[model samples]
Target: MDRIVRGLALSTITSSVVMAGGYKIPEQSLNSMALSAAYVAHTSGADTAYFNPANMAFMHGGKRYVEGGITLAHLPSNEFQSLPAYSGESEVEDIPIPFLHYVSEAMGDFRWGVSLVVPGGLTKRWTTPVQKAIAEEFTLKVIELNPSISYKVSDHFSVGGGVRLIYSEGVVKSNSADAYNQQLALADIARDMEGDTFELGYNLALAYKPTSDINLAVTYRSNIDLDEEGTATLYGGGDQLYHDDASVSVPLPAALNLAVSKTWNDTFTLEFNYERTFWSAYKALDFEYTGTGIVLTPFDDPIAKDWKDTNTFRVGATIEMANKITAMMGFAIDETPVPEETIGFELPDSDAKVFSMGFRYQQSEDLSWGAAFLYDSKESRSIKGMGTFHEGGAFLTTVGVAYEY
Candidate 1:
């Protein structure tokens, strides 16, 4: 499988406010955050399980490394005020996102690893009358469990693959009267839905090392169609459609990454990475409902997304500081997938540039700890067809500990 995930960028809300181009969060670990998600080629820690499992084959023999961490995120306020009395900012709180990973040393040229991570998600809410009609609230929570194994074909080549299981939960709210431009106004109608689903996918990776200082890696994460079904409650407007069936099918796009890294002497290492996300798979958002006559009419229409694929470029550096401590910094430029015609309040996204920094401390022969921070600077966008507003940046901080033997 070959794919690069799409963006989940909405105005930052909650503690885990991770904003990228669209909705994909590649920074799942401390090192990944520090490196602006460009650590694939030079991966050496437990995060290798999620970043580049193939690199596990080059780890020290007969050793096990486990690491765990949590990241804190903040998305500032945003405002979108257009005609027709539609305007409002967001009220988002801080959130903590936790992750874990483990990688085992090579055994007969075979190595294995596992990871529990959050690939991407979204959270947003609005209070404005006009904005509330089409998009009052939209939130998504996801967790992924991946287990992988790698084989060393030679001293210079290794290949790896993993199974991906994702659990997704979501809440969506909107006003039917507003959604139809006041065409169906029985009492300012609104629809609410809460549901959860599970999906399956896979990923593949290849790692190549030329000599001891240079490494190259390429990885692909497959796409998953999120199939969700839950209860629907239609309140107000003489249309009492409550506790009914509701469902929708959305996509988690695939991602492909290519990276190259090398160390100069013993002091510094640098890496560059390029990512391609297949957002074209997302063409529309169509809701399905099974309810009484005329009950399902308003919410069953298809909303076109017309999203396009995107490209991301990342570069990072590591400095071997004194006392078993190391410093890292990175930068990245990411693109958005949403077309201007489809941009709206429900999922306002844009291109972005990010910067990051972090450090790690080795406490002993068997224990180590790390911390990192990243900031996202979103670009301002204006769409004539879709009246939306996004005015904010995002902040992320992470701390982790590792044990090795």
Candidate 2:
């Protein structure tokens, strides 16, 4: 049944930001967040290292740039109500996410850079009766190290690519007392194992500038399969009834972003981005158990996901306000990959409209500090057979410093 899918799927929610759009977090940095991830074709600083490495070639007389920051994400509680039966509320805790980027000054025609970011993940918990039966808590944490290089083909064109090294870990848990039987009562989970793993992927990009005031770009990130292998234990009557080594694998999905940006009068800039996510790679969640043991309950079943690919539209505008402060705002229409049948307790995700605002204070030609904020407004959905998801969203705040030489 799809019951087990909720447990396995919830384990896929790696972090607060990854909770967006089926585990993908587009806002990895301050400027990227402030611009609603529309900074790809209009990179202004070191953040180009990840969003558009090719644009690093256009930093203009700058030798090197570095930016570091953290995002504080406050996740709202999720309210669930089903016809003729279940109802409850669950919320993931607030999370603090950190990231860093560095782009080298061009030496000849080549520029190199590196980025440390959280690409995707899952985190959710439930204490209510209905969902607690199979999805008490599911958690995942992931980190990625991306290093890249760009080649300036000419004054107007550039190309770049990078290798992705991703590290991840996940856990799943669910238990109920006196739910199915009159005697057995138990609840708890403990584990650490070979499931902590590292995976690899790649990305490519192209940037074109028809004029110094116009920038256009496209980038593609390949999919990475996070296969976790570890020990799993199931309890009954306050004791361990099943114990064994287990394994499960899920995809991080591929994504493509295309953007066009224009600077007007050298003071105002606007950019529009179209992004596509390949989420159909996940059809089901199956758990494998090995050695002298048995799989039971949530771990013994396969859950169907049948997720589909989705798309998003984003636009951002930046205005240089005064001597040093540049203000910006962004808007996006984000689509959800999860289908109606698969939506469950672990993640109450849905299509969303996002609004963001922030500003950057340029301390000097070589130093700057900035802050940004965003509100994700998830659209409510009424399911025919499933529960009613009282749709909600998250608020994220970010602050950081950058330097160039």
Candidate 3:
């Protein structure tokens, strides 16, 4: 029971290679995806509400800004090669994510904005006998709503903060009724679990413009714990063994970002960003079960997760061309928090290089439309005694419309 529960808990929290360092999805808007999440300091649209609310204080007064978009994500299957019987490939996944943001007209020196976005999620399924025994199916979905306010302190400085309302749902399933388990003299063990939770946090931002051509910004998002409570059904020897209530807790680690941008001749802009993720908050996976006379073995002990913090660097270039067109390109280097000693099937993550490009066209005086594409290339990782994982990566395409009135 303990072993199955541990696998379920991990798969439910972190398993998708399409996400960022952990299970976080950082590209929630057209500009964000086009710039590999490097649009923090030089935001020019309603998305400022989500990336850096402080920028709203500096926006053009007497106008309302609105932006909405959707992203299509395609994740390729991960190939594991080693011993023939131990080798398998994870199933391919395709997902659609949507985002919306709005900024209100200024009221004196104050401004307000709101955003609806998907912050993090995951989905992984393995059908091979060996892999299925650990993670047959694991899925997680998350959503967030943020409302923020900003104050213009001076000509060059502004401050803002927001409340984070989050909701999440998860499903986990595993089975071990196979010839390999029979060879090991083990019983036909299996488990099914479902859970959901709602949590709260906060975010803060600061923006400064010392000169007309330069911009600087900083942002922070607080951590929130997801306490998932649900029911679990266990099986042994193809027979129902136990049915009981279960619960587990995991952290949606905090993050901090520092960004700077410089514009040349008011036609070209370049931006650089640094991001820090505090994944160290996740130390262990402990599941509690409530059932009388239920033997707790292997499943009762807490599993160690000793994950470390990670850093990401990004750079972007934007060119304002003639004919009401804007072109953007970006690159990024991302590091994984999962250490080799603790890496497993649930989350086999690695360092990656990201590339992105996009263009926006101004169709009318008050309407604009754009499209963006991003590619995440992951490096192959080798485990000491297990196997090597290769050919893992993700592709994303985003389309959006913006209106100002």
Query: Alpha-carbon error at 384 in model 2, in Å?
Result: 1.8
lDDT of 3 by residue, 1-405 (tens): 233334433332232212234546899899999999998999999999999999999999799999999998887888878766667899998989999999999999999999999988877788876567666777777899999999999989999999999887777777766623534214356667777889999999999999999999999999888887887676656777667887777788899999999999999999999999998887877767787435234345666777889999999999999889999999999998888766766567788899999988999989999999999998999877667988767898999999999
Q: Would you give me the overall lDDT of model 3? A: 0.82
Superposition TM-score, candidate 3 onto the true structure = 0.93
Against the true structure, candidate 1 has what lDDT? 0.78
Ranking by lDDT, best first? 3, 1, 2
lDDT, residue 135, model 2 = 56
Regions of candidate 3 where Cα sits further than 4 Å from its true position: 1-20, 179-187, 292-296
**C-alpha lDDT of all candidate models, in order:** 0.78, 0.77, 0.82
Q: What TM-scores do the predictions have? A: 0.90, 0.91, 0.93
Model 1 lDDT tens row, 5-73: 001111111111112236567999889999999999999789999999999988886899999999987
How many steric clashes does model 2 contain? 9
Query: What's the lDDT for residue 297 in model 2?
Result: 54
Task: Give per-residue lDDT, candidate 3, residue 200.
Answer: 95
